[model samples]
Target: MQHRPIKTAVFPVAGQGTRFLPATKAVPKEMLPVVDKPLLQYAVDEALAAGIERLVFITARGKGAIDDHFDMASELVAGLKARGKTAELASLEGTCLEPGRITSIRQQEPAGLGHAVWCARHIVGADAFAVLLPDELLWNPARPALAAMHDAYRQMGGNIISVLEVTEAHTHRYGIVTPGRSDGLLTEVRGMVEKPQVGTAPSRLAAIGRYILQPEVMDVLAKGRRGAGGEIQLTDAMAELIGVQPFHALTFEGTRFDCGDKVGHLMANVALALERSDTGPALRDWLRSLEL
Candidate 1:
């Protein structure tokens, strides 16, 4: 059965990035830069690559900077054109989305992931849409994980979530998926447990940031039931749709960096820099020269 095309992608950027502390005090955590582009840009570009027609940012009061970052700076463009700076102008191309193609909704409160997603329900109205958490940066320029998940959604015609294996000890840190059957990278998600107590995890496979969810999920999220951490957990809402709808997880082939963590954020910068042609050689040499 063919499902509705996923044209809208929702980004939850309302969180207070307490983990980064002072740096995030004045800036949205999603604005944090890795290498060069902000974390949110990578997620936005990935969503656009997956054929998403519109972008919806679920934001909070202090997150206006996220909106400003995407707005076209006419003066900057004019300066570049006048100075004949084509390279610099080209860099901004990826940051620009056509007018009306992107919009934002105020989450109003720090409810939780489920609540954040529900904030965009009106825009996503009665359609299948993709959800991307910018903090989970997946490095795979050749084939973005979201694009791959979109491809699967076309054939499978149901909810598709991106997942990867975490260490057994780290299972408590993620939503553990219970597998019914598997073929290669795809697995039937029989059920899932959110932040399962250490040793009680059902499986080592943990759901990551990318998701292609149907409209019914918005209804589930609307209930605002709290779980795990006394917050509206999206995982619980997703679990409710399992047997009622087709649900599966794709074990994406790419390196993931939890940019929410300082160490992970630093690691992402180094990893991406070392892989770039313009920076790799020098960066690699410099890394080798380090005494650590």
Candidate 2:
């Protein structure tokens, strides 16, 4: 079957980031620096790489900083250009968001992930769309995780969520997929259980942050049924679509970091730091010095 094109993507960034606390008091956690870039920039680049034209950010109050991040820095760009700082100009240029290509909706309440996604339904309209969780930093050399999934989406439609093998012990932390047949690196999803009990999991394939879902998912999320932790969960709504739609899981070639968690945040920074040309050698030396 010829898969439908994905023109838009929904980014849910409404969380209060209470986990990071004081530091996140004024600064949005998405703006927290990871090496040279912020968390949200990584997600935005992933969406753009997947040929997404419209970017919808589901935000809450005090998220003005995120909106400002992509806005044109006219005076700053001009100053850099006047000083013949070409590299600086280039850095600012990459931050530009095409006029009107970006839009925001207030999630208002600190509800579940499903509610946040539902807020952006109108922006996504009636078509297949990608949804990327900014906290999940997917690193890839060939194609970003979303782009790889889009490639799979060319053959399979309905809903495509990225899956990575997580330890059975960690299954309770993620939405685990019950695998059916394998399609290249993609797996046909027989069903999904959000945070299933240990030893009772259908499979070790845990749902990551990337997803290419049909607009029909909007209908499911609209019902806003509270799940898991009292908030309406996205996983619960996605579970409702399994057998009904042609759902599948794409095994993306990338290392994913749950940047929302403390340990995961530290891991992403250290891993990316070691990948830098100038810092790689020194960082490696430091790691060797630690000796475990």
Candidate 3:
């Protein structure tokens, strides 16, 4: 079951961040700062941490800012050098990726997550690929969640998706997995149901943002089979891979934040801030002083 190493990761950033509204009008939601760094940076860092070398971004119109954020800015670098703002200059290191390491594809239309992933077919070729959704941030886990998924991927070598337990009552809000035998964190994904009705879910485990999918998923998505929302749902395509292909859902090892939601975004910022030595002490004191 040897397969090409998961060297590349695809990011689907084509959806309009209507959830963020005016702020997203000019700034891509992916560009929204989680702390001082943009949300996308965290996702990129996770990919890099997990041994991902090349990044393929599926973007749409008005999302040029994503490229700009990663593009090396000569003037800014020179200014930081002249000013001797060592800390500030070093902070920019995460933002500028090496040239040619990133490939951006225009998604033309916001068909769905599956469509966005399908656009990267040629880029991914036949190798197994990783997909990280910027909206879902795995806020500073003890270790990289994707890295763990990569570990499981190398051993199991099918399709791996990171999942977390949601309350049984809240199962309708996420893509639920029909779980099979479990070995610690790894659970065999016998089946999947996207946003199932409240009482009809197969299990409490819901899919998260991290994924290691075979390239065949692109071909499945190419069928343009519309599911929920009349859009080509990635879950539906991934569901098509079960039984025939080995599918397992790995329970995430870290806390995940849905930055797509306003409260979750704020919580991520505060949580990350509270973990920083420079800000933690003061922030902790301030939080203690507050009367909730």
Best by TM-score: 1
Better of 1 and 3 by TM-score: 1
TM-score for each model = 0.98, 0.96, 0.97
Error of 2 at 54 (Å): 0.7
Q: Model 3, poorest ten-residue lDDT window?
A: 138-147
Instruction: Give candidate 3's TM-score.
Output: 0.97
Cα deviation in Å at residue 151, candidate 1? 0.8
| lDDT of every model, 2 decimals | 0.92, 0.88, 0.92
lDDT of 1: 0.92
Per-residue CA lDDT of model 2 for 103-212, tens digit only, reads: 98999898888899999888888888998999999999578999888887887778999989989899999999999999679899988888887888999999889999
Number of clashing residue pairs, candidate 2:
0
Query: In terms of lDDT, which candidate is strongest?
Result: 1
Worst 10 residues of 2 by lDDT: 87-96
Return whichever of 2 and 3 wins on TM-score. 3
After superposition, the stretches of candidate 2 with alpha carbons farther than 4 Å from their true spots are: none
Question: Where does model 1 exceed 4 Å of error?
Answer: none
